[model samples]
Target: MGNEDFKQDKLIPIAQRSFASYEEMYRIVDFLNKTLKEKYNIMFGLTKNNKDGSMVITIYEF
Candidate 1:
């Protein structure tokens, strides 16, 4: 099978805060996951968390 070429748009920083709690993080992550899946058909997994407790989202490309 031939390979499919894909191009990604520039990444814009997106931040969401709710009551300064970790529960807000889950909502943001879930939103990001669904958006990426619907828009790019890609699945991302959590790679790491910073010392300050912020998370890093990883988009895996096939």
Candidate 2:
């Protein structure tokens, strides 16, 4: 709607992650960590989703 809102949306988005197994999840996390750090110079955090037993990776910019 507005320029400020658009910029905020670009900063953070709601995403969903589902994996068939823990190994797949770990692989994805590792890949993302490497890519983000090497290309964008960003670091991310991984956390466990207690409700669904899934993993969540959050990358934020300050």
Candidate 3:
């Protein structure tokens, strides 16, 4: 692969919320939000139950 591909891979395309319970999910969400803001200066749009009862988190680079 090329350097660009490697970099892209580092930016996760899909992330599923942890198997932890509701409370844990909130903690994870908050942690992820803060971490992204601090490290990449990015904000993610978190989606819970996009379909059925699944949770998805997506972070787009600005």
**The candidate that achieves the highest TM-score relative to the unseen native structure:** 3
lDDT of each: 0.51, 0.58, 0.56
Q: Decide which is better by TM-score, 2 or 3.
A: 3
**Which residue pairs come into collision in candidate 2?**
none
Evaluated against the true structure, the overall lDDT of model 3 is 0.56
**What are the per-residue Cα lDDT tens digits for candidate 2 across 1-62?**
98645544555433544433363656766788678754654445567777777766666441
lDDT ranking, high to low? 2, 3, 1
> Which stretches of candidate 2 lie above 4 Å from their native place?
1-23
Each prediction's Cα RMSD?
6.7, 7.7, 7.8
Provide the global lDDT of candidate 1 against the true structure. Answer: 0.51
Candidate 3 lDDT score at position 31:
82
- Return the TM-score for candidate 2, rounded to 2 decimals: 0.44
RMSD of 3: 7.8
